[model samples]
Target: MNTQFIKASLFAAGLLLVSTSFAQNKNDLKNWPSGYAPLEVGKRIAAHFIATPHTNFGRPTPPKVITYPESCTWYGALKFAGASRDKELLGQLAKRFEPFFGPEAKLIPVPDHVDYSVFGSVPLQLYIQTKEQKYLDLGKGIADKQWGPPEGPRVVAASHEFYKQGLTWQTRLWIDDMFMITALQNQAYLATGEIKYIDRAAKEMVVYLDSLQKPNGLFYHAPTAPFYWGRGNGWMAAGMAELLGSLPKNHPERARIMKGYQMMMASLLKHQAEDGMWRQLVDDAESWKESSSTGMFTYAMITGVKKGWLDAKTYGPAARKAWIALVGYIDGNDEVKDVCEGTNKNTSRQFYLDRKRLTGDLHGQAPILWSAAALLQ
Candidate 1:
């Protein structure tokens, strides 16, 4: 053989092998996800998130910033760290929430809204685990804010007669508030040994369940909107699961709350794609595979198993399957992919169907972390 041609052929063969190995590493996730630990993958993703911020967040994208949605990811980190009893991870995760509440760590008011109060979950989780007075105080502040008088709906027209008459909180109702605010209330109850917070949380949940939950067992993104945006519904389920995980068994509202949660979980079980993920619209067949909602549903179900609220024989495999699929979305670089961008409730199905799915969006991180924590049990 000619020397030059042989060398060229050898180089070409080497290139082919390199390409083959790269492709295999990529595809191996779908086929061999059981080898990956959800906790490790979750930790890596959370670490990468705080280190490098990525977004097409619509408005100005600040360098290395964290926002409300990403709070969920950190909440999951808190859960994972607390579950593992890893003091280092707990301390690390707890500090990540400081900015949201301001330097003094007081619950910086978000004008007349309850949305920003969701960040309380982080401090509350830290307080619950560490028994640190600072976290407890901050978390209590937020819970009291959420626990206080009705601000009414931020969308003026959204304050329907039903909400005005039925809800107890001073804040306007948003579907996201379910997970955003409720968990903090439960935490406040735990933090202060105050039955009032838990009682208020139960009333708040019923108010939402009455007005927002459609017969389909999923929530409308808002009062006037009938769309079941995946993450919003996921928030409802995850929040309820969070509440149930901590609420006293004989608490007056436990039966009603569990009924709603079970109804929603049954619907979630029905809608889950065979691939172990839920869609962006949740009910819409045309929507994309949404990682955040999938994470939330898995958290809800796995929590049920851990709390003895769900049947392990049934939900355990489902959660593990969901975890496998969820971890697959995290790339070798630790970027979480296919996370739906920030969305508002809209009247049309196309609105949800068209939402952007971005890589490393913080909203995708929490559910995976929480799932890992729950599964570790």
Candidate 2:
């Protein structure tokens, strides 16, 4: 046989093996890291909470929304914990935030607008794990209120932010939206058997992806920007990981979306710094290595390996190296260090590099959790 034929035969055999393994061990497949219980990491994270004069119940709340990445990270960890081991500690975390819903949820000042995208996800995730209608209802209300009409065949904006005293589409679709909105929408679809949520998410994701693609197959930070942000790419990558999990295997969009992921991964691999961490702007080495983006990308690559979207032989070593570099950014308590604080929309290279780095920030921690979760799998 020719080389092409041999390669195709091997690919088919690999798929067959994977399918057989999955069918044989569906329950065992869900359980990760042989010999380890689910949510063990979550319990460890919860135990590290140190009550400060400012934080209530030892829960650390940084003043900025970017700092709250841990909330979502912990939220994911909680869900995995709940699913694998029937733990209630994860549920308690959701309950503590219940009082903050509706009129009680306080708004932060920096962004001026309530980040429904971020807030919406955690409650929705909680709803999935607990089967609690209240959490679902709360998430639905927020989603409904914030969701922007579909912009075209593919674009939708759930909210907008103010930049340069003008109302730009706060809907400036970035990769992060995949994590914040698509996952929630997918869960809603599963919970309600509603096609609208999934339909909307799919359309919006396509629009966002189309707008960001560059000639080199890498995605830009936004529609108008030439720069590619690592975290932004990470968001989209991680988003694809989640979407693939939920989407049916035969969905028409599946092949195209998977191709897009492969192309992006190819470009991303080329840009990884020597240290294994990606800078704020992926192509610029002058920019410092930032943990949030690196962790998210690591999570994406690792998930790709688990899902068979990426070749483990090719990407696994890179991911492992990135994880080691990422661990260096974590402090003693697993708090993330040298994380870029929340940034406004910027179109320049300097703008990306100049974003401030904060230690033990939640934005970094959440991605760290995601990376850890992926590694565990």
**RMSDs, each prediction?**
8.5, 10.0
Give all candidates' CA lDDT scores: 0.74, 0.63
Residues 21-43 of candidate 1 have per-residue lDDT tens digits of 76545422223344466556756
Please give the lDDT score at residue 170 for candidate 2. 36
- Compared with the true structure, model 2 gives a TM-score of 0.74
lDDT per residue as tens, model 2, 10-33: 999999999997655432313444
Clashing pairs in 1: 73-366, 149-170, 150-170, 151-170, 151-171, 152-172
Query: What is the clash count for each candidate, in the order shown?
Result: 6, 2
Candidate 1 minimal-lDDT segment of 10 residues: 26-35
Query: How close is every model to the real structure, measured as TM-score?
Result: 0.81, 0.74
